[model samples]
Target: DTAVSQTPKYLVTQMGNDKSIKCEQNLGHDTMYWYKQDSKKFLKIMFSYNNKELIINETVPNRFSPKSPDKAHLNLHINSLELGDSAVYFCASSRRGSGNTIYFGEGSWLTVV
Candidate 1:
């Protein structure tokens, strides 16, 4: 069984369009995160949730929103997508206070035209 899973592994959309990526973790972790990998492969944390509570929210644009309906599920929604928004979105999970040990999903590749 996959520890972390996300839907729509690849997405191609036009600018100004809205889209969403759904993620789930079956590892029973208390913390989950949304990470973005840019063109240069520089990874940055976008949002984090612990037991369905908002925790770490990075300095991302208001267009990017993360919603966690439960500790095991966290979804990312992007409004008015822009070309610069093209990147790999990774869903990750880790035990609270586990210190750097994180399990990542296969990643959702989004391309904006």
Candidate 2:
């Protein structure tokens, strides 16, 4: 079974539209995260959730929201998508700590036109 998976590997939409990406993990990990990789390839943590609890990273915008239905799934929802939102969003999972190895999904590319 796949350890982590994200739907719609590619998304192309116009600015101001709302979109959401679904993520699921089978690794039985307690912690899951949503990360954004910009055009420069700099990865930044947007949100982290453990056992359905929200752990927001300060740098993320208010327009981005992460929802965790359970320990194994974390989904990302974006509202009023802007041109700046064009980037690759990666869903990751870890055991829940600084020392744990983070496993990433294939990533979903969101392009705002």
Candidate 3:
């Protein structure tokens, strides 16, 4: 079975539209995260959830929200999408902290026109 999976590997929408991306993991890991990789390839954490609790990165905009239905799933919702928001969103899972290796999904590419 796939350890982690995300829907709509590619998304193209006009600016100001809202979009949501779903992610699921079967690794039984307690910690899950949403990351945005910009055009420069800089990966930055947007949100982290463990046991249904959220730990958000300060740099992330209020337009981005992360929802975790359970330990196995974490989804991202974006509102008022802007041209600057066009980037690759990746769902990842890890045990916790810096000790564990973060495993990433294939990534969902979002393009805001």
Candidate 4:
């Protein structure tokens, strides 16, 4: 079984379009996160949820929304997506607390053209 999985691995849209990506994990993890990779290949965490509850949002824009329906699922929605939003999005999972192994999904590539 797949430990972590995300749908629509590739997305191409124009500026201002809204889109969403879905993610799920089967590792029985208590914490999940959404991270974005910019063109320069810098990865940054957008949101982190523990047990389906919001725990961190590192100054993520309102256009980016993270929803964790349950411990195993975390979905990301972008409203009026901009050109700057084009990047690779990754979903990850880890145990709660400090110094736990983190597992990541393949990644969702979004392009604004």
Candidate with top lDDT is 1
Off by over 4 Å in 4: none
Compose the digit string of candidate 1's lDDT tens values, residues 40-95: 99999999999999899999999999999999999999999999999999999999
Candidate 1's TM-score reads 0.97
Worst 10 residues of 4 by lDDT: 59-68
Query: Per-prediction TM-score, please?
Result: 0.97, 0.96, 0.95, 0.97
| Candidate 2 residue-wise lDDT, 31-86, digit = tens | 99998899999998888998999876657778998888889999999999999999
> Which residue segments of model 3 deviate by more than 4 Å?
none
CA lDDT of every candidate: 0.96, 0.93, 0.91, 0.95
> Model 1, residue 67: displacement in angstroms?
0.6
- Ranking according to lDDT, highest score first: 1, 4, 2, 3
By the lDDT metric, which is better: model 2 or model 3? 2
* Candidate 3 lDDT: 0.91
